[model samples]
Target: MDNPYKVLGVNENASQDEIKRAYRELVKKYHPDKYVNNPLKNLAEEKMREINEAYDYLTKNSQNSTYSNSGSSYANNNSSADYYSIRNDLNRGDVSSAERKLNSINSQDAEWFFLMGNVYARKGWYDNALNYIQKACNMNPGNREYMAALQNLQMMNNSYRRPYNMRGYSDRDSSFCDLCVSLWCADTLCNCMGGGC
Candidate 1:
């Protein structure tokens, strides 16, 4: 759609890292969470779709060009293309279709697990999402994307506290108070002995 570099607000000669940074910034700006319950939600969604398309197009073209120029046969190219399609489906809120497409693929690479985790996460299956994302992280420890996904999933799982639920202060605060009382007593004793509080 148009020039991907222009869509991402980057020059055609920009490095991959620069392109990725621009893509991420656009994604953050147009993310659905930012528009929740707002009148601009539809517009935000459209922007997000365009951003995703631009990122995908640039990434796929870059990979193809690099591989072709190097005379290298990328065996995972097809699966990678399918993964991008699945990602687009997921971005469009088509979880069932994405899952079906994922299941049709035989390979279980890091990207596969990552996409599966995304599907589960979208469905509110946090435990399953964590498991799959952790697997993806394990498979590709150096992958920033997978690591970020895992961290995000963990944060989501940990941050979901019921509004009516209250924490008990008995165990932790009691020990802390006891320690403080003992310290104060020791300080008073030292002051009496001319040590100064």
Candidate 2:
């Protein structure tokens, strides 16, 4: 393994708080849930494992005092981790599992609605998807992720309508090309957040 300080992206002379902060950021970035269903999932898991080991080593070896991850002290704590796991299930094409997990969560924050919208979208329930995503956007007006998801849903809705309007065909007859373009745009949006799609 690399030097513990280097692994956590901190220098040897850094204070404990600096090390903790860097570790937290890296944990969020490389969490296994973030990479699940991506081609890089295994790499992300390995990186996370490395980070945990480094964090443990550094905290344990601190000369003045030893700190340990006692569950509550970690950055990607349980509640956030639960959300990440739901995202992992969704990306893995396990909408049912994701939905079940989401439903079990009591809080209905912007993230919850956004994820529910994604599940509805996956299940081809466009009306429900739009409603939930719109609610998410309303709850957190400044969130780009919610906005992008809503736009992607709207684009898909428009794509389905354009074919029926122009060719007098059913929405099911929408061109595959339009669908692909919409998906490509959505994936680009997700990529801007560091990972997804």
Candidate 3:
């Protein structure tokens, strides 16, 4: 709705890395769980939604070239635009369409794996999601987005206990807020194990 850059708290000419950093910070700050018992839960959800929209818009419209999983620079080609479209599909809860689009693509680049992981995640296939995301992270080790996705899936997998329902066992699932917090906590834990965050 508003200017995407302003919504993400980034300058109009900000680098992609800078925009990404701001997006992650905003996601952490406005995560829905933080306001679960607070009066601003609805506001937090709205803010998070706005943040996602802004980030998606920026990524889709960016004209700059970026390093691919193979450490080679790639231009924003048709496939790249298709990835953005797939992201929109996922955002709109159209996992099947996203998956179909992914299957149609031949290039299994870092972004491809990352989006495939997202598709699996949406399908409640956490294990597959984790594997695909981990592959993406390994391919583009320097990409914080891939790393964050990997860590989020890891934390989701580790923390899920699949609580028993009154009648029987139900599937365990994580919300976007849960996944975001899990990513932060997992990153913190990993860093602490080595030294510190």
True-vs-predicted CA distance for residue 114, candidate 1, Å:
0.3
* Whole-model lDDT values for every prediction: 0.77, 0.75, 0.77
Ranking by lDDT: 1, 3, 2
Tens-place lDDT per residue, model 3, 34-123, is 998999999999999889987876785454336334442123245655776787789889899999999998877777888999999999
| CA lDDT for candidate 2 | 0.75
Give stretches of model 2 more than 4 Å off: 1-78, 163-197
Poorest stretch of ten by lDDT in candidate 2: 68-77
What TM-score does candidate 2 reach? 0.51
Off by over 4 Å in 3: 1-69, 72-76, 161-197
* Stretches of model 1 off by over 4 angstroms after superposition: 1-75, 161-197
Candidate 1, 1-197: lDDT as tens digits: 33556779987667789989999999998898999999999999988888888787768656643433232212355664576678778978999999999999986877788889999999999999999999988866766677888999887777665232324455667788889999999889989899564
TM-score pick, better of 2 and 3: 2
Model 3 deviation from native, Cα RMSD in Å: 19.6
The candidate, 2 or 3, that scores higher on lDDT is 3
